[model samples]
Target: MMAGQEKGDLSLVALTKSFATFTAVHPLDLTIPQGSFFALLGPSGCGKTTTLRMIAGLEEPSGGRIHIGDTDITETRAYQRNVNTVFQSYALFPHMSVMDNVMFGLRRRGDKNAKAKAGEILELVQLGQVADKKPTQLSGGMQQRVALARALVNRPDVLLLDEPLGALDLKLRRQMQMELKRIQQEVGLTFIHVTHDQEEAMTMADSIAVMNAGRIEQLGDPATLYEQPRSTFVANFLGQSNLVRAQVNPGGTDRIVTVRVHDTDLEVSREHLPYGVDDVWLGVRPEKLRLGEAGGPNQLRGIVRDVSFSGVATQYAVEMPWGQELIVVQQNDGSARAVLGETVSVSWAAHHGFALDASQDAAAGAELVEDHG
Candidate 1:
């Protein structure tokens, strides 16, 4: 854990898990500050669930340490850890009412006021009106709320949520996202949520740890992860991007460098770029690329291939001579889109793109090609 890590903070150091000859998760080192809404995001079998299970003590790590607050709970039993998990399945009893389900854990702990606490939590989750209803009588969203109230009834120091909103419809999922964030803020409990939904992670988490192939590719706040990704995987995974080939050239100071993209060569401030070599891959977000009104240092001429209206924004597929197709998205304000087959000038500012290494570019490019194809 870092020096500033506070009490009730969660820490995992050199955490590893394996099954026979296959390694499910590599050694992970992460320190989550107390009262933070943190997310472990990745695809299925990418080790995200395994990491969460380790933290919850549901699956013992093959090796490493797990700590909550100032105490080390590496070898602690699952019930001994001050953590509660809200799984995808509500796991509520079919015969029991909502209040009883919420009070189940507290009853096991022999709390004399468990019934009162359960009633209070049901109201907190806005399920007070359905306190006497069974799990089968409740809607999908209502069932999920009951699960959340059940997990939180004990007032655990940390809460683990594994795709808690997976079964809800799109509209309900959006509503629950806000509700979950609000509840976390109100309780001030550390939350470690696991999900594959990028938008959900972006909307609710204070900080996200994006995992790929059993390792954390990048971990930071949403703005930093989206604006200045350190690797190609990070850049391409979060959202749409235009990864153009480029060559780096020496500039005035060792910290600065010039990048050549296609037919344009422009100076760039390389303060955040760690790679000091000449060969690089530049990544630009779709919104950063402006159309029409030419004459810029980094400019490219391309023919518009396709355009689609999406209510809030318009998407365009532009083609270049190199057989590369770039995607650009512009907000809709009742303005007409550029006609297909029209030659338009595309340009962006220096701060809009980040240089990437060859290996990172290769990974990003392969994924882009696969996604577009």
Candidate 2:
């Protein structure tokens, strides 16, 4: 299945799922570019896991269709589809050695070369030295490697992962994130990873689908998704954002729009906004916002109500004139963070704020359906 295959190519059309009175995922339509590291990111109960399961053929969709490259596998059973998954559980056999666990899938296919292939995959995941170790003997990270080897051993056209790093500790999770990326690049396989960690998704995925209630809120590169979310839900979900409800100022340049928030008018750049018309949410990430100097084109006066030192950076909750608490992040450059109860000016470049439309909001809410259901 190697030569002439479109690596990692997948297409989902109007995919949806419902369980009796509850809807797990809303109808979704997306085309994942071949061989791209795509992330489905959302909180718990978000349909990310369900979506991955649907792709893996573990759960049938309530509606819509699925296609893998040129093959239409909508009705195909899980085993018949050319896809494999590394679940969050690792799901390795505790009684079997690493090599045996990896070889399990191949053995079921009656491949006499299963041992050779399993050894090669174990080496690829840097677990060759522990090929004979049982699951209980290996560390969490090592066990994860075995799980990945098990998935990759089949050489599937696409690999799906569901929070594969969720079980590891913080440091180990970070380490594994890099290792997973390296392996994905090495294999040049299309990897669809489901994760709730925004930083993890941003670090690993070439593009991400930020889901809400079984629907896609935004799909774009990490920079695009973070810098220019298309709806209020997306603005608030991906990271810490100050959502200032505003309207586009009429008679401004296409790239510049004025919005009214809290009895004050704010002029923001529209270049980053995804909507055509501007009844929009001013989406600004905490880091994109700056404090201190005032009297800028896009600026706001606010009182710092609270502050917390988080080692690497300082977090401030600023009460803006609009009565909304805006979060501001200041890098810890060896200086003390801003103090609470201080009056400060918070501002960002117009380009940093984005406009969103209603459909985007609905899509964002849909990304969380599974978590809630």
Candidate 3:
């Protein structure tokens, strides 16, 4: 541990936040394991930021408790909490040098080894060589790293990052994502990152909690959540998914359900069904689908509407007889490309389809238009 820091898990019980008649966060329970990198991911107005702020003690909850290990800190002030936040704004003292900015927090806490500790953190973030340079002299990525070093130098039990890479360009954001993950692992502190970018959360976090409409929609590791989404919202939000309405075959075995989609039978694993229902939404990722002759158990014939070649892969939008489009992605391995207006067969493995309750909204994952007025 660095200086005054201690390793502790963070937990929230029935936490809620409201402003007048609007509730920003509903009462929910969450526990972040010690030294684990967790992410709160969602779109705007989803209460992810509010949840993070409540844990940081920057936003007081309307009800419930916040705890670090066994100690209740719900009533603790922002500065009194054993947590530090790194926001999108680097918030570095522009006039001060990188070294001075990193040491400022330590010196204020009356640590005698402030300079030594700052130097150590600077090296950890790979910014020791530019310690003498001011924030203006550094690149955006470098400034963000300096801000990270400053926060980590305090050695807070938990580090909160509020879209720290939002201001960076695409390439730089990808670079910083790996860098942040590396730094978090090296320091062994719990990191709670909040972001609207799905790729960013999936790339860096050990576990992710998908939030929406002031509640958690789903929570799991990256691969599990991506491969086996529990809801249509999660399936569409995390990545591209083709959801087709299907009905469970009447005499199917419990281990596998034969779903009828567009006059074709598709075998889906019964284990993927969350509830016992005859009506279901068969979900499959675009990459899981293949374009070929109709010889598989799950196969559909459609007219190719469009083709997009994106270097690594080719995406095809095939329009079915019912006017629904099925998106398929094929790796660019020198295979013959499908031509638009040509009829083709699309097939996927039986187990690749995930069944969700049909009662759920078919447009659950559609993007909401934000009111800017």
User: How would you order the candidates by TM-score, starting with the best?
Assistant: 3, 1, 2
Query: Model 1, stretches more than 4 Å misplaced?
Result: 1-7, 252-256, 294-297, 334-336, 361-373
TM-score for predicted model 1 compared with the true structure: 0.92
Candidate 2, residues 1-373, lDDT tens digits: the string is: 3222344469999999999988889998999987889999988777999999999999999999988877777888887777899989999998899889999989987889999999999989888999888999999899898999999888888899989998998999989999999999998888999998888999999999998767787899998887777666766667666666676666778678778766678777757655566566666778777777532567888899988888888888999876788888888876434677888888777777766653444234324333321
lDDT of 1 by residue, 17-69 (tens): 99998888899999999899999977667899999989888998999898887
Native-referenced Cα lDDT, model 2: 0.81
Task: Estimate the lDDT of model 1.
Answer: 0.82
Question: How many residue pairs of model 3 clash at the backbone?
Answer: 0
Candidate 3 TM-score versus the reference: 0.94
Estimate TM-scores for all models. Answer: 0.92, 0.89, 0.94
